[model samples]
Target: MPIGDRDLDGIIDVENSRLLSTYRKFGVVAVKGKGSYLWDAGGRRFLDFMGGYGVAIVGHSRREVIDAIEDQAERLIICHNTLYNPTRAKFLEELFKVVPRNMSAAYMANSGAEAIEAAIKIAVKATGRSLFVAAKGSYHGKTIGALSLTWGPRYKEHFSKLLLDVHFVEYGDPKSLEDAPLEDAAAIFLEPVQGEAGVRIPTREFMTSAERRCRKAGCLLVIDEIQSGLGRTGRMWAHEHWGISPDVMTIGKGIAGGIPMGVTVVSSDYADVLRLGEHTSTFGGNPLASAAAAAVLRVIEEEDLARNAERMGHRFSRGLEGLEGRFRIPREHRGLGLMAALDMRLRIQEVIPRMISNGLISTYSGLRTLRFLPPLIVDEDDIDTSISILDTTFGAIEREKRSM
Candidate 1:
């Protein structure tokens, strides 16, 4: 169906009836997006701070990404991994230039979950161990292999019988790593900044400790940068903030500039563990996504979005922090480079819709934290506008509490 012809109600009804009821609806039928804004089916413009869960790294409908996609699609879209394609080769070349120097090999997949799954296979094959270590409150992905390492039982309780052996350690606590059993572990999965855990940032000591422990146990350090990489957190990779390098790294959610693409990058030492036909994906690194991703890399470097994210993120965080002095709602504000969040005193379910009604959109971490992932291209005006909307909504909610 044509996007313009579909009304909000029709689209909503079709999705609610036809799709699996696993996702929580945001109540906005977004039809178009450009730069830092989204347009609903009713032509309402919204400041998109959620950025499609950090997929729109370069922002929605970016000309460079769109042009790349169009140009590649006109010639070819899909070429299996068995064949060497120029676009795919170009993407790998672009990827290596930005990644850690040791990361010389990559396995392309379709989503962060696929990337995590591939990392799991690579770790096991490379280390020849059955156990793994992950942190508490960590969220890797929902696939079987990735879920085994994820925290929270709600996602894996039903599939407990199928999961692998994984030990959960306390995040940001070096003592926990020292106490955990890691002698026979295949890998230790860590996210530089825990996004789903309300933008949790670990201390440099903890990150270095994990790296040390991985070396001590003869296991690989697999950093999952799916949400934190690609200049989302000021740095190209969040782990760089701690000055620690991982043996294997999984990245997605903007690698292809909104196209579905995942990558499991490995160091040169373990590059050849996955032999021919041991692992492969049909649409991984296809011509269309490869071209788009290559363009995304160029845009990030050429435009210096990382610097923008740093400057804008500090401004946005300060604005949010200032609200704590005037409002009785948000308890605290914490974040790093465009990935800001407010741990609210009230339920975020009531707050998100109000902000949406006021032409702003954000996401939530857990139940009380309002997470903001504005695009790397966001300007001071956009940040201020979002802050104003949040301030207004938070004030209104506080007033209602006073009345009650």
Candidate 2:
């Protein structure tokens, strides 16, 4: 069912010839999108369970977001970061209202990594400490400061000298923090749910306990909500689930509905730590990105996407549960809200092709977990369709293996 640009293979060939070899493209060519589905180059539509790494919360081809972009582009698309912009201000105002308690300001950046860079700078400046704490299997971003916080060996091995002293702790274990030398650390950063680490969830008690420890020891609490925030976890912010607010919050991914944007929101006490010109981004608060973000925010609130995400996530989980081995996959499913990962113990790399053939899109992650981040705009019917396809294929695998 692929459409557009002659044929699917044609586009693949074109991409191979024209694009850089460093990046890989899936075999399918996405021609267009709407709601929870994307049409391939041959016009075959598949449910986007991956949701572009959980960025399109309102789904693809959203009218308001497109219109906002169109309108902004027609007016003023490119502007320097040195000056203030109305659209940026509007986004910040709306952002401040929904940001967790005590978050007083925001510093906009171009992506999640940039946001982390800003966050690390803020923590170091506020506390006058060089060290920060991050958890094993936690993903912050790929930039230097963010990469320092990222504990994956694949992501951090080559640049050992470039990275800083970010103590690694066991995720979901507050006792790790309790045992650490928190007094000298600048900040403790974590994701409410580890997305790249295969949708692992930290215990709420562990998170709250760490917050207490940070408070007592003068360590800053910085949450990398780039993936878990913005309704992926059903809650608007994943940290809200633990009832603890951070001194600084970094948000990206779905924040601007597929646009390149990230923001570091701060509490009042630490808001002004970075003075004027202390930290500035060239494309941070441009009008067009802000306009896109504003529209995305409105749609999220109007549609009550968080509620939808919560409801649909449970339905997806229940639909897939109790079949880890039955499906011939060894996954134990875990995640919060719509951000679910099915941890498969099998080599299982071929599951994705079989899934694509059955009209679904997903990706594998840490622990061999296949991550599912269906857009917030996805409905019950889409969920049902996806499960039906998944159920059929998984059952077939199990049956074929048993016969063998």
Candidate 3:
């Protein structure tokens, strides 16, 4: 039961005994990470493709983020929102410069779920409506309020009784939203690019139509950019791709350069829904997280990581598509920028582990899709390396299947 750099299996056993049984983890016990690579406890190196579920956009252990956090930790860490702090003020000022023009105010929190919860409350208080609508296959979060808006039977079945009144329509179909009863709904929650549901990108026409419909119905359009925002999709915001403005937007994951933070950016008209005392978080806009966020914004601007994501993502997608006929199942690529996925005809549960064994770490969105959220800082060489590893893994799997 010793915990000092034990074997992978031993560490996993120790984790099982001590941690809650909520996560399905891989065997690798990551000890360190830096810029698209992770080292296991055994000193084995892995080319990271998951990016900690898109939380490492600026790259793991970025120097700017580390320096900012250290500096802020030495100066100040937490201060109640009652008092105005310089770090928090600077972070908010910089944040406003990057978000959508319609979004003039922000509510900072600790995670994506908290941002979603705040958006829900804001929508309810603003419109005085009790019902909500979301797209099918959408994933907002797992918290009580967020989960109610999330549309997945598996995640909601056990906690069905605790959810609220939420109606779901087919994603990427404008007619579905038009057919739903959204006139009386408080808000319509959507992801610019559905991440957990396998990096589904909607059509520009569909997005514009949904925006028009929501405006006509007087329902707040809440765009959840938790996984797709912050330059992950080659733009400051994924909704920018469609040229549509949302009433409220929830962002997290990589907003603070891997530090945990969530922000609900709201339009100026609806910003006053949550009164001063109605909604507040003790650590929402603390100095450390705000400092990290300010540093993240600077890094994204200085490094031009969003443009890199666009170029690398296109190259990676083409490489994946090139392997279409070489495997037992055809590989179809879909996504924008660094948030990409390969839709395989077969379940990728075993294939992902094989890729990990080959020193390339990845994740699967569902039974038949391998999702890739490589760091935005990745270069052409990194993309090539990942593609090469995938080619070998797919070839080996095909050979094994043929032998059987």
Candidate 4:
């Protein structure tokens, strides 16, 4: 292995031997990225449709982010919250501009899970209740507190005892929320667009019902926008599509362009619940990450990337929808903005590697859905190229199956 890069075999071997087996391994050893493309150690370029799991909202290695990181790094990296760093203050000011008007305060953390953890604490303190309601097929985060809200059993069965008391309800069904036991609940958590459930977009009626139910039951509405926010869903926040404002909101993924950051925005109605020193993070709101996040906000506003996502997302959705008719494997396409999915009759495990081989990298939500989270900066040309890659890869796979 070298300083700047490593051979593919060496990189793979090192990761396989030294790292935990929690991650689904991919063969491409990516060494560099710029805009909507990633370059592997072997010098092959890949159209980054995955967008680093929606963390590259402004595209990889964006110059503004780089400059912000470097400039902040040179000046200062960490200034404890008690000291009040200007960079952290600046980041919060930028963040508040995009969130709901009632969301008057925020707590910054290092990842979505951390933000969710903070929200859990806030909800508990505000309502004095321990029970929560979350939708089935929901994914808030993997941390213990956040994982309690997540629906998948596989992720939390062993650690269930450490989790919160959360009741699961069917997503996109207003009746489910109405039937749910919410009187004693602190909050009802949900995603406007379910990403890990394969880009499931709920009906507007369902969202309105949730808000109504929360209000009637005296429970807070907590929206998890870790995957669907920050212009990825064509809107500043996915909740905008349904015209709902959450009492508490958790956002992460691309908040800092690439630097790790998570935020829990609390409405003024419940902002005073948490006392000083009741909950705090050692690394939260560090100047380095704050500076990068501030730059990301500026980029989103200056580039009008949210509108671009709306335009390009329609193009991408149409292309994926067209494939459903041409290929036997494709069953349907579902998505909003750049957050989209193609459901196939067959599992996409094998199809994933084949797409990588064809210079396209995608991800999956479940066994049969091919999830695409392209950069918001993606153009019509990028959408066409990705569609072409999907066509070629599916054609080859179908041909192989026929010959077999």
For lDDT, the strongest prediction is 1
Q: Output the TM-score of candidate 1.
A: 0.98
**After superposition, candidate 4 runs with Cα above 4 Å error:** 1-4
Candidates' TM-scores? 0.98, 0.95, 0.98, 0.98
Q: Rank the candidates by lDDT, best first.
A: 1, 4, 3, 2
lDDT of 3 at 38: 94
Candidates' lDDT values, in order? 0.92, 0.85, 0.90, 0.92
User: Per-residue CA lDDT of candidate 3, range 158-180, in tens?
Assistant: 89898989999899998898798
> Taking the tens digit of each residue's C-alpha lDDT, what string does model 4 give over 1-404?
36347556767878898899899987889889999999998889999999999999999999999999999999999888889788998889899999989999998899999999999998888888999999999999898899999999999979978989999999999898888998999999999999999999999999999999899989999999999998888899999999998999999999998888899999999888889998888899899999999999999999999999999999998998788878887899998999999988888887999989999998898899999998899998999999999999999999999999
User: RMSD to the native, candidate 4?
Assistant: 1.1
Residues forming the 10-long window of minimal summed lDDT in candidate 1: 1-10
Better of 1 and 3 by lDDT: 1
Which scores greater on lDDT, model 2 or model 3? 3
Name the 10 consecutive residues with the lowest summed lDDT in model 2.
Answer: 1-10
Query: Tens digits of per-residue lDDT for model 1 on 1-404?
Result: 65343477778888899999988899899889999999988789999999998988899999999999999999999999888899999999999999999898999999999999999999899988989999999999998999999997888979999999999999999999998787889999999999888999999999999999889889999999999999989999999999998999999999999999999999999999999999989999899999999999999999899889999999998998888888988899999998888998888888899999998998889999998888899999999999899899988888888899
Compared to the true structure, candidate 2 yields what TM-score?
0.95
Error in Å for residue 214 of model 3: 1.3
